[model samples]
Target: MGLTELLFVKMTGGNPILQGLLGGIVITLMNTFGALVVLVWHKPSERFLDASLGFAAGVMLTASFTSLILPGIERGGFIPTFIGIILGALALDLADHLIPHSHAVLGYEGLAQTRLRAVWLFIIAITIHNMPEGLAVGVGFGSGDLPNALKLMLAIGIQNIPEGLAVSVSALSAGLGAHFYACFVGVRAGLVEIPLALLGAWAVHIAQPILPYAMGFAAGAMLYVISDEIVPETHRKGHERWATFGTILGVMVMLYLDVALG
Candidate 1:
């Protein structure tokens, strides 16, 4: 069988589209697991949160390079991937410049600075960070390579656990009231992926040629988040060592999974 067909056999037993949507939903829901931590235990320490964010940054940075950009280079060549990366970075730069959002500890970013409540600001910050992950998942499936897409889904889902915890912590710090509500808010923040995944798959169907560019773009977008948002947020506090270890661990785990699953 061909590669896509073989990948299909390995994922969901046959249907790439169905598998794609299901994978997207499953990965996004992983966010709830982190949020659930708040219900079972006390809020995590700032050091723990910083490490988690750093871990997430590591995972995404690896995914961008190993999973997305390289595949784009293989499929569409160097020039396309290069341009896509630049465009992706530029797109994120524009969003960062135009939107107003607050980081976990870094205060407010984006051009449209505002006096918005901390909870809302936290939501905006995470939303911007996560939406691209959903897109990456979608693009993976859109590439018609079920195994690669599944790998991306697994990687992103695993990393999202820490992200969910970070979001819950941010909400609580913002005085978002009862632990249950904050956890709920954190889990719900990931729900945007449900639709975006489907849309990305559909876009792929409509324009198959764009797959390589899309992959590169997704990589660039994710890289932007890692460098501009997650890394800085992780290091803004005093847990630089823990965060560094977390980042190393995260990268190793993702690499292992990629090899094991591939």
Candidate 2:
């Protein structure tokens, strides 16, 4: 009976806008699922975690540079791309300064409070970072570049697993509810993509000239995350070797995907 009802709901396709909305929701849910797996199951050593993060940083950085920023420049030329990158970096920097959080604290605090705060901060930062990625996915789909779109989506999705685990473990060490915290963190990280997708689609339609800038902006934002968030957090774990390994692994994985797909 329950299955029948669900099937009926699934079968009933609706308006175009509604379809897009549903697609966005599905994508968000998929991303969340990936994050949840990382959060609940994986218990990576500090060294491994740091290496994994370094790897993720490498993948994202490469993707931002080669896949997004360079392409935007090729399509839109240098001046616009430069402006976009600067604008994107500046926007995130401004947001970081304006948003109140405990990113400054390095040492230990009370376990529960510390973990809770860390979990929330990690979620917020990743959520912000995912927005542009989601936007890129949406733009790719909107532009009818289905192959590239899927590639980006898959890459980002796989990358988020390690990211989610990193956030979850940090929070857990800080003394948060493992499952609940993971779920919320995953949901928060994934949900931002919806608005990003919508906005990207709209921007592509309304200001075609700005697409290069937009891509550059996303690249810049991603670079900031690599520098400010991923690198620093990885260093905190003091696992330089694993981190380096992870970094190399991540780069290779992305490179393979780009070659196979792109």
C-alpha lDDT of all candidate models, in order:
0.82, 0.64
lDDT of 1 at 92: 87
| Each model's backbone clash number | 0, 4
lDDT of 1 by residue, 14-69 (tens): 55555667667987789889888888866679998888878888889888988899
TM-score result, candidate 1? 0.91
Candidate 2: list runs displaced more than 4 Å. Answer: 1-27, 38-42, 103-122
Candidate of highest TM-score: 1
Each model's Cα RMSD: 2.8, 6.5
Off by over 4 Å in 1: 1-15, 113-116
Worst 10 residues of 2 by lDDT: 103-112
lDDT of 2 by residue, 49-105 (tens): 677678878788777876677778887899988898898788877766655433322
